[model samples]
Target chain A: MKVKTKHIMNLFYIPALLLFVAFVVYPFTQGIRISFTNWNGYSQAYKYIGLDNYIRFFKDKNVLGAFVNTIIYGFGSTIVQNILGLAYALFLNSKFTGRSVVRAVIYMPVMIASLIMGYIMYFLVQYDGGAINDLLILFGKAPVDLMSQGPRAVLIMTLINILQFVGISMVIYLAGLQNIPEMYYEAASIDGVNAWGQFKYITLPLLMPAISSAVVLNLIGGLKLFDIIMALTAGGPGYSTHSLSTMVTNMYFRGQHAGYSATIGIFTFIFIMIVSNIIVRYFDKKEVEM
Target chain B: MVQNNKRAAIWRTPLAIIIVLIHFAPIYILLGMAFKSPKDVTSRWILPGYIYKQNFDIAINKGNMLAGLYNTTIITVSCIVLIIVFGALAAYPLARNRSKFNGGIKAFVLGIMMVPPLSILVPLYTVMAGLKGTSTYWGIIVILTAFQLPMSIFLYTNFISAIPTALDEAASIDGCGPFRTFFLVILPQLKPITASVVILTGINCWNDYQFSLYMLQSPKIKTITLTISSFFSQNSNNVNAAAAAALMGILPVILLFLSLQKYFIKGMVDSAIK
Candidate 1:
């Protein structure tokens, strides 16, 4: 009986293993190989360029600028979004009336596509006729060019992203909140621990897992952000908001250096791997302690 | 003390109301712009006097919004179905069997999840083109399923492992074959996880722009994301029309999320943290 069961298991396993190898393993190896050659995306013949593309990437100022912008966007969105999300989670997790309705309202932005959000936000931030500028005029304040200038443009775009996805972080945090035993809060209350102390001791520490996950996901999402930036600014005004992916897309489309674009992609892969691995390791360690 | 408690409640209620309004400010802005006339949209904050049918008509006709909607629906539904069927089947064995290979399979799937989708875009695009899958409905659907398969399988495996093994044994003893046992017994037990998968994958597939942009180039095959980007390019000045188009695109998703907010939130929280 046991041998027959094992054979049945093998039948299932073989097909899955084959699919994984064909789809994932082969493509990954091919991607790395293609990175080292000066092959146009279509061409069959190309010369090997060992480390040449990498070296060119270092010298390229736009690539460096994209790297900086990615880091800024990543850190900016991750921190702001998670902090707001955690706060909202805590607020809704309290004993409140109509909590479900409040949650649905707040989470509305998360359902719509980021691309659509970007387009809508563009209308809301335009200089002449934007919803925001119109409101500013009503208050006797001068209209601000939210999407025209460099720093403000990046800032507004980051804010829009945060608004659109913070509900996701909140949901994760809410799950963490539910996992905490009610006894902890009761004990804190019996000890006359104020809300601040109870939250500091009970909520923050216990919520670490969700916090780490949210941070990692948001950081990666922010770094890999291309759709929104493409829709909103198209790396605009002068590539001020160019991300790694956008830069890769631009380079590949420009059609001179597919190899260099692959190099940039490889670098991005390595960077994301390092950052996410660190966060994962940190969470794994915390998981053991908690 | 009672009076003080009532006073506190009153203050907190207003504070909560204010926060909710602030949170929903963007949607309100969009709705306001969608309804306003072009001249009114550009002017001060005074309310528009009339409904703007022209913007909706223009957006629907000039932007080809309905065609975009049709394409998006087809891609989303097809991808969701493929992910549901294949992902569940692949996950069943991994969940039931405990072996070193199973461990490796889990790790491989998890590793693929970590790799940014952009890194593989060029190669995947080449492969799709080579397969003559580019610019076809099947092209985007296949890629979507392939990309989402790992994560959906992971979720299903996690949920399935928690089910008792006695059920499987009982089915086998009752003369049910493995295939029948799976479909009749195991598949029904997967409703919760399937709900999660459907909600998550459906939303992601609907919202995806990058894959659709590269894989589907024909104007006739454009998804909502590509269509919206094109609208921005072509109708930069028609703010009300663009807003109307944008509203049309997001309204269905917004309504779906609102109706299923509980399941949606639970699914997201569970899968994400796990």
Candidate 2:
């Protein structure tokens, strides 16, 4: 009975394992296989053109641009989100009236579908009859088309992502703050430690875990940004604003280069896996030292 | 010192209020656009003076907002149920048995959580196409469940690890098999953690766009995101009706979040800081 139950316990996980194999593992291997061929997604008969996709990817300026944009979206959102989120957490952690109300208001956007948020921002930023442009017109300034410029469009979308999801980082920091005992600060104050010193020493080291969590989550979310780009710019003015995620879809659907698309998909998978692993390990090291 | 502190509090209240207003601006614009007439020619900043809800009517009747909501509901509910069952059942042994193999299983689960589904978009879609899973509720549900299961397993494993092993031992000594012990003893104790799992998974499934977009291509069975997106693309001139469609898509979720504020916040902390 003992041996059999142990086997049963292990068997419980098989269904989950099967799902992963069928959905994730199988498709992933197929993605690799398809990357070697020139399958146009509709054709059953396609020839294997070894290393052509990789060679094209290396020489392709658009792919290079998408890579650069992905970096901006990923790291830019991480830095801005952590700063704003920590600020919000520090401010809201105080003894203020209607504090919960403020937190709720801030967090409300995180619940909104990001794609819908992107569409809503469209109304505000459209060149003509837009909410922001209407406000600008009151001061006799010309209406500016915000989404027309590729770089600015990327930044605006990143900002949009930051605003919507900042609540998450804020709450994680809040919970981290609450986990800390009040006596640490009280003791620091009695020992003549300044506010800055207390924050630098007591707060920073202790909040490392939360920082790690928030940063990693933001990085992953930003790296895979697709829906907002689609809703807002649709990789417009060229393929200028496409992240690797959107680039893959655009390639397959519009460009019809299924081989290159699969290669990019594989590249993204490997790239993110490497990046996240490094970040996790780096955080692990920092936590150990602290 | 006392006077300075008093002045600080006075300034603080207005600062808080300003922050609240700024953060709430997106919804404010959405509301303005949703309620106003298309020909009003007024700035989105201006609110409608009278009750004009024709935009919403247009969204409901023409945009198929009701059908979108129904399809989304079915997909979200089924995904949540499968995720919960599969996640909890898998976490049992991985948490209970601390062997090398189980440790490897636990690591694999965490690894899967990092996979952005967009990475597998092509082959997965083809696999679905082959299985005739495209445009069907069950196909999307199963796919969503598979993707979300890893996070659920991670959360469950952490929670279950904290429960006493002695309870399992005592149940075992009382002539209970593994299945019996788990269903009766372990499953009941998972209520709190399960709430966290449910809310977190529920939000992801409901707000899912990329998966729904790729899978449900047919107009008749559109998800909320798909329907709203198509509305924007198809009717660029009808901004008011599109905004109304956007508002309709989000209202239920916003209401749900406001009511369950504590659970939502708690779940984020749980998912992240663990």
Candidate 3:
């Protein structure tokens, strides 16, 4: 009877599973099938071109560029975001006056839509009468067009993302810090441990869960960056700043290559899975050691 | 050591104020841009001495912001309610049942989180178009709920797991079936987590772009982000008006975040580490 009741309870999840099937799983399988065909996205008629789309992607320079940019966007921002966030968390956790106000100010950006924030940030980076250029002009320096270059534009976008979302990591760490009882710190003090020693020996090890959560969250987010790229570059300045996410969109919408787009999509899905799994496993091992 | 820390705090306060100003600069530029006339091609750093009301006027009329607001509100509210209900409902059994099958279900849900919306953009758009779901409120709501459900379920699962099973056992002994036991016993206890889910998922649904871009392509059905994007695309020259529209987009969220400051911060933290 108990087992039967439990099975009945399990049935409650069927609606959610069905929705996932209809939206995510079904479309995902369809994407794989479409990747083999020469469908231009709109028309029903097309031929199965088997592995050619994948072959083209492997040989394509744009795909290579986008792949590299995606990694840079992912790991680059995650490294900076986590370190900076941990620092801010440490500083604010010490109960300074206006700490709440400071935290709120930093967090304000995360509330704005990324698409809109991208547009807003563009105001500062725009060439004529822009904020950065105005400062350069203050020192009588020639105004440089920031977004016109590829590597420079990519770095700026990564910095923008880190600045915007760093508050999230800080607050996560703040909570983790609070969870550690004051007694631990007091005991460390009695043992004559220095501040750095206490942090190294006592605080860092205990905050492992929060650290993993912040790092993984930032990594996954950075990997899937799309809206900001759309608003800022539109995968433009000659496809140099495109992430895989934006690349997929541009392929389908502008280049009229639905089949090829689906192939790249599959690549992105698998790549994210492998990378995130590796990161998760790495953290899992560290967690066990701690 | 305590005395040294206090002295350090005095120096840190000024540094903290500088950080706050730097973080707040974009919004300052945005505010300046929105209130300035187009003829005033001054640096974005300079604030307009007087209000320029025409920018907001142009944004509203040209950007279709009123329709966008209405459509976004309907979609956001409906998606939030569905995500909360479905996410919480789905999490209940997965939290309670320690079976291998249920464990696999939980992992699959987590896997769904890693699939970027753009990766599935092609087939998902094709499927929605086939279903005549393009430009429809119900269509976008369903899609948004599905994408946003995983985080909510993850939070709810951890939350429900911490809940004592003794309550369920007691309810079952009192002649309550699984459904009744859940409704009567487990559901009320979920108020705190539900608050977190609402803030977290609510923000996502409100700020969603990719799904809404494809699903709600019609101008009449455009959300705030779509409307603003279209406005920008139409005229790169219309910086002031676009700034106004973008300001409009940022205001509701900023105001909500300020009012519900605790929940917003707590929701962000809970969704991550807790």
Candidate 4:
């Protein structure tokens, strides 16, 4: 009877497993295969280029620039966004009126699509007739070229992302805050612990799970950042803000070495997998400790 | 002491409100731009006293915004339905049984979630093109479902595991088969999580631009995001018209989120914390 029941369970799982292998597994294998070929993204006639594409990618200045910019953007966005988000979360977690309204308002930017946010920011940051410039003129100060400059353009984009996505980290922190028992704070207070002391010992330690999640999410998002870059500057002013994802897409569409673009994509995928696994494992261990 | 506490509370409340206002200023700018005329948009800081219907009218008429709306609705709804159905069905055995196979399957799905969509974009595009699925609604729908499956399965598996197996046993003893047991016994218990899955997946499908841009080239099959992008590219000078189009594009998603805010918030928090 138990054997029959096991057979029935296997029957139920077979179809789903097949679909998984076909849709998820097959394409991943095919993607790896395509990375080795000189396929022009359309034709089947192409040679196996061996490690040449990977080698060429290393020598390419644009590819190197994209790599550097992507890392900088990812690191910058993750650190700034998390810090700001945590600060905001702590502020709201305090005893206050209109906390719910505050949360709703803070989360508003996150609700809008990134592309729309990018377009809106473009108008706001443009040199002439932009909202920022207009405000600057009103203040009797010279307007700075936000999108035309090199590193500053990327900085401005990162700042916009920080403002938009800080709400996600804040919400996660709020969840972490709720999970901590009030007794800890009360006990600390009895031992002559001030507010900062209680926060340092109780809040910081207990908030590790949320912090871990926020870090993982922000890192992944920042690394894969493309939509906003596409809309904001189109990786513009000579690819100053070009991310790996955007560069891969541009190269593929521009019809200049599809295999090389695939190689870049493969490298990015492996890099993300490594970083994410490290973060997830580290956090999982920490969660077990807590 | 009482006076000091009151003063602190007063200061904190106003400060929090100011922070919230600053955070939401971008959305207010979007709304403001949507209502301003093209000329008024040049001086964006100043409030426009009147609604500029011309931009909205032009965006709809010239941009074929209605067609884009139809395309977005069809794709989002279709993809959401597939994700819920297929994801729940796939998650059942993993949740019910405790074995290496089931554990392996669960791990595989989780691993797929980490692979960024950009990594698979080129190959997936090729596959769709070869199958002659590009430039069609079904193509985008299929790609959306495939990409969204891992996360949806993760969510469904987590939710389904919380359900007791005794329900399945009871149904089986009553002569119910596995399929019947899932639909009648287990699926009803999945409503709350299903609501969460629908809202999250629905919002994602509605807002996706990359897949649509790469897969669909025909204007007839364009989704709202694609249409909005094309509109902006074509009419770079018409800021009000662009803003109006953007507003129209996101209205459905915003309304959906607003109406289901409670469920959406709970679902998101629950999924993350889990």
iRMS per model, in Å, is 2.3, 1.2, 1.1, 2.0
Question: Where does model 4 exceed 4 Å of error?
Answer: A10-19, B1-5
> On a 0 to 100 scale, what is the lDDT of residue A44 in model 1?
76
Which regions of candidate 2 fall more than 4 Å away from where they truly are? B1-7
| Candidate number that wins on DockQ, 2 or 3 | 3
lDDT for each residue of candidate 2 in B120-167, tens digit (9 for 90 to 100): 888999999999999998889989999999989999999999999999
Weakest ten-residue segment in model 3 chain B by summed lDDT: B211-220
What is the per-residue lDDT of model 4 for residues A7-74, given as tens digits with 9 covering 90 to 100? 57656556555655665577677888888988787766899989888888889888888888888778
DockQ of 3: 0.82
Candidate 1 per-residue lDDT, tens place, B1-274, comes to 4585576666666767887887777777778777887776355344466787888898888999999999999999998988888778878878887778777878887787777777766667776777899999988887777777777888998888899989988988888766776799999999988999999889999999888888889999999888878987898887778888899999989889878888888778767877
Query: In order, what DockQ does each candidate have?
Result: 0.57, 0.78, 0.82, 0.58
- Alpha-carbon deviation at B267 in model 2, angstroms: 0.5
Question: Could you give candidate 2's per-residue lDDT for residues A1-290 as a string of tens digits?
Answer: 37778888998899999999999989989999999999998789998999999898889999989989999999999999999999899888887898999999999888888899899999988998998899899899988999999999999999998988899999999999998999999899889998799999999899999999999999999999988899999888798899999999999888888888999999998999999989999999999999
- List lDDT for all candidates, in order: 0.81, 0.91, 0.91, 0.81
Output DockQ, candidate 2. 0.78
Which of the predicted structures, 1 or 4, would earn the higher DockQ when compared with the native? 4
Residue pair clashes in candidate 2: none
lDDT, residue B115, candidate 4: 79
